[model samples]
Target chain A: MQEKELIPYLYRTEFRKITAVLCRLFGIEHITIAEDIVGDTFLLAAETWGLKGIPANPAAWLYVVAKNKARDFLKRNTIFNEKVSPEVQYSAGESHEIEVDLSPTNINDSQLQMMFAICYPGIPPESQIGLSLRILCSFSIDEIADAFLTNKETINKRLYRAKEKLKQDKVKIEMPSGSEISDRIETVLTTLYLLFNEGYYSASRNTVLTKDLCLEAMRLTHMLTENKNTDKPEVNALLALMCFHASRFEARIDKNGELILYEDQDISLWNKELIKQGECYLNRAAKGDLISRYHLEAAIAYWHTAERDSPEKWEKVLSLYNRLLMVEYSPIAALNRTYALAKVYGNKAAIIEAEKLGLDHSHLYHILLGELYATVDTQKAIRHFTAASKLTKTSADRNVIRKKIDKLKK
Target chain B: MKEFVMVYRSELMGEIKLTAEGNMVVSKEWENWMGGIAAQNKLVSPGMRLGNEGRVIKPGNVVTNGPYAEIKEIIGGLSIFKADSIEEATEWAKTCPILNAGGNVEIRDIIQVNG
Candidate 1:
């Protein structure tokens, strides 16, 4: 491959590995420093390779540079030397060369540790995701801002506060043990779920679907499944849910990048491989006694991947949504469940349930109301669509809602 | 053929705040542009990135902090390539990947004094 193409592929695959290893060595308290060092290593690689061409083993070259950078940091900074050097010496030896353990096992272990560190309960869910995207996923602050549908300054501040909290709490970069692991995994899974949803149902105007974020979430979740300690049924269920959702990615957006509703989407575009994988995970998830929210959601997602216009699929989806609401009481889930209610039952019954929920403030509620009222009361549907258009922040959403209003008027 | 030096200038070079992924994309673009020049066998020098920290020596053997304190743009790096004329060199400089990062390239012909 060309150096241009190869560098990005390596960056996507190796950047986190290097960062995770360095974070383990320097400790989570100095994560930013580790990130900087890794960033510099890549920059140096680009500069050197542009001139001398790519080395025989580029991955090894990166490791060597990273090691040198770590050594240089330890030697130059008295604070780092005093704090980190002794720990290194105690772990390995007193040799002048700083031996960082970047072995395959250690790399995986470090990533698991970093995942736990990022998902620490002390940090808020949003901030946890911000840190995960920034540290683990290697997303720039600007990119995170775009994902959040906010400004760079806001994202920067959120990341700063999250990292500061980590430092203040002295959050160790290690996997939780036994009983604590279950609770900690919930936080990690929740963060991953949010990350996936952000990509799947992205609010950004420029890009309707952020596929990379979804892929990143799946990649991280797969890591959890690889480790025996974290391969819980819920983790597998979440992976199944992500896979099912990702399988529909190609069908989700049109040539113009407009949103395609589930019913309107072309079924042929759905990825059969990902759907099959989702089924495998869902089947595996059924082994555990605990039926978590992810289990219900995965079942709901599984129904989504079914053949179009199947009444049985709608029935299964509606039942799963009911169970999901009972297990986890979220307004968003309730709103979504009402949509499935419309599919299984009638629009009138769904409208009654949706109205009872008192979600007038949510654009989704208005949009759902608009869709339900389309066939029955065109005027009411138009009003709901107009309300939804006003409530939405992005032009893309507004345009979709406006099109609905225009169709209702006709 | 005449040799020309392409000087990359940008404010981003001063701090280097890009994330690893972002840097990779930028570096990849650089690699492609440089690789193209290499393919044509016109690349003279792949160039060196200037460090942020440096000192300047004046005529009286006096040294001071270099590159000026208040300049918005910093000389990021340089590359040399052979072309038939300044126009051809300018055409090549126009495609420099530095432009993607909101940077500009300054092309200067390398004078051959003893050739």
Candidate 2:
């Protein structure tokens, strides 16, 4: 990366890592203070690096500066001095200087613990996603707003309320113990799954799906799979699911930035490396007898990555979608299953099932119906397509729907 | 080369709410300006950013709030540069990141007496 790009890159990677370590060191209740300190550290870095030119070892420079800034904060904040510091001193045990332990192992452990903390059941699921994005992913409030396609004021208020609740409850930044691990892991994985979707399904008007958001989600999920304490078959399955979807990211959009329907996508554009990684994670996910929604979804997504469309592929996809909906009865999953139904049983069957969904508000629902009706009922297909174009938010979806309508007219 | 201090100032406006990423772009701008000076080997001291609040004591030992507490414009930070003339120093100050934020630069000559 150029010098211009390096700091923001570092901010994205190192900010969360340091924030995790500091939040762990200072206590999660003072997460705001920890965040402020990290912010100050970067600002100081900005000033100092500008004057001094880029340091020989920028990352090391950052850690050192963070340590100094943190020490200053510890000394200056009397509340911490009176309450938090003594316990910290005891933890340090004989080292007069408080160790801002930035060791790789410690950073990894802290981040994993933070992942669980932010995704705690106590925090509402929406705020859990917000907190995870803000603290765990180092996303700014504005970026979170952009990610959710909401305004900053709404997201700001949401985050503030969530953080206030966290402090009041004194949520500990640690993995859930013993019997709680299974449920906690599920919560964390679900948040990760949603985070990935927030990036993947940037279907709203004007915004294209960003790779960074998806990569950050995958990075955190991969972190979970690496940790022995939190690593579960479900976690691996989630990673596998993310990997399979991410592999097709390039193929999903055209050069002009319009959405490419799955059937029209070039199979060659799919990332072989990610597909291999997905297969590896899937194999690991299969080790356990348990079949989470992610496992079923990963299997479904994995089939989509196959180079040649086969009857067998759609059959397996159809079966997995059936199992997935049984495990988790989401309307979106059901909508997707209708496509598999079309592939296997024919358009009429799919159209009948899809219309029953009555998801009139969703452009996807109308588009799906339009697609299913194209071969059988020309008038009905155009009606659904026009409805879909009207309901659709993004120009990409509008273009795709419009092209379909035009094709049917021809 | 004569030394000059570029005292940068800006309006004591309300906080410019920026995302961390947004702050970074500004930071990089400062970096570019500073880097340009350092590249020319004309930079003396990086100087310092004044704290937002400080005390002011008159000769009567009359303590009062800092100039920043009341002043519409406050000194933001300063940097030293070596240039042949004030005009040359002013040239360097023209591209200052502070100016972009609606601040201005005051160029003052540093005089040597003993040497």
Candidate 3:
């Protein structure tokens, strides 16, 4: 790959690995220091590679530089010696070498540990996600703010507060014990799901279809599946759900970056390999009796991957939506179910159900209503479409709704 | 071709608080800029970076703790490059990455004396 392409790819892939290793060495209190070091490593790569060309083994080069920097800092800072050295010497033994080990197994272990540390329950869920995006995914504050649909100041404050909380609580960087593991893993999975959705249904107008966040979420989740202690049915189900959705990534947006309604998307563009992998995970998820929301959602996503015009597909999807709402009563899920309701039952019945949900503030609700009323009542459809256009944030969504209104008026 | 010395001066280099990562980034920028000149066979000498510490001896045999204690700007480093003219050398200096960090490059023609 060219230097421009390789730098970013390495930045995304290696940022977490290097930070995790450094954080493991410096302890959680110095997470920012670790982040700074990793950032510097990338900046170095960008500058050096522009002249020297890409290194033969880029990962090793980063590890060595980061290790030397960390060592230098440790030697110079008396406070680190007093506070951190004892712990490092105890855990790693008295070897003066002070290796910043980034072996494959250690990398995996450190990441898993970092996941637990970031997802500590004391930190609010949104803050947890913010921390993960910043430290684990190598996202800039601006990018995290964009993901959160907020400004940089807000994200910066949130991350600052979260890091303070971690330090105050002295959160350890290790997987939770047996009983605690279940609860902690739930939070971790939720954070991962939100990260994936941010990428899948990105709020930013400029990067609606960027897949980096989604891919990062998937990469972290796959780490859970690989570990013996954390691997569970729900984990597989979430992976399956993500895989199913990712399979349609190509068909989700047009060249103009407008959202493509599922019915209008080209099914031929869906990835067959990802669909097969989703099926494999779904089958594994079905083995256990516990019916988590992930299982239901994965089932719904599975049906979405089927033949678009098939009645059986809609039937299965609608049923899964019903089950999902029973398990978790989110208005968004309820809003989505109304779409499936329209497909299986007629638009008339679905409109009744959709209107009762009282999601008046949501543009998606009005958009769905507009779609449902299109053939039945042109005037009502135009009204709903107009409302949706006003409620929408992005000009892309507004333009889409405006086009719908124009078509109906014609 | 004539030889020119390019001296890098920066006030911000001492004031800016850099983490290890930030230092790496700055180091990479320097490496890339220097490497570009080397690639073009225009580099006469890669030069050395002067540290913050040094001793200065005045003509009266009086010693001071170097670089002038109160000076805001310090010479961070210097390198020599072969260019056809001072204008060509200045053109190359314009691309120096140090300028991005609020630093400036001073280019002077290195006159050759009789051997």
lDDT of 3 by residue, A1-410 (tens): 88878877787778888898788778888888889988888888888978888889988888888888887777677645566757675654566555677898888899899998998879888898889988888788888887777899999899989988998998888779988888889989999998898788885655542487898899889989889888889999999999999998888788977788777888899999999999998888776567799999999899888877587887677666665654555767777777877887789988876776667898988999999999999999989998988888888788778888999999
Native contacts present in candidate 2, fraction: 0.00
Ordered list by lDDT, greatest first: 1, 3, 2
Stretches > 4 Å off in candidate 2: A81-87, A91-95, A204-209, B1-115
Give the distance in Å from residue A105's predicted Cα in candidate 3 to where it truly belongs. 1.0
Task: Report the lDDT tens digits of candidate 2 across residue range A1-410.
Answer: 66668888899889999999999888867788889988988888888887878898888998998998888887677655565656677775566577889999999888988888888777788898898988898998888888888899999889888888887888887778968899888888888888888788875433343566789899999988887876789889999999999998889877776678788888889999999999999999977567788899999889988855688987777666665654555667767777877887799877766765657888888888988999999999999999989987777778778889989999
The regions of model 1 sitting more than 4 angstroms off are: A78-82, A85-87, A205-209, B1-115
The true-versus-predicted C-alpha distance at residue A182 of model 1, in Å, is: 0.4
Q: What is the C-alpha RMSD of each candidate to the true structure, in Å?
A: 27.3, 27.9, 28.3
Q: Return the TM-score for each candidate structure.
A: 0.75, 0.75, 0.73
* lDDT tens digits, residue span A1-410, model 1: 88999887788788888889988888777888998999999999999999999999999999899988987886687745556757676654556667877899989899889999999889999999988987788787778898888999999899889888999998899889978999999899999999998888887654533889999999999999988999999999999999999998888887888788877888999999999999999998877578898999999888878776588887677666655654445667777777777887789977876776667888888998889999889889889988988898877788788777777677
- Comparison by TM-score, 1 against 3, better one: 1
Candidate 3 chain A weakest lDDT stretch, 10 residues: A203-212
- For model 1 chain B, give the 10-residue run with minimal summed lDDT: B19-28
Chain A of candidate 3 scores what in TM-score? 0.92
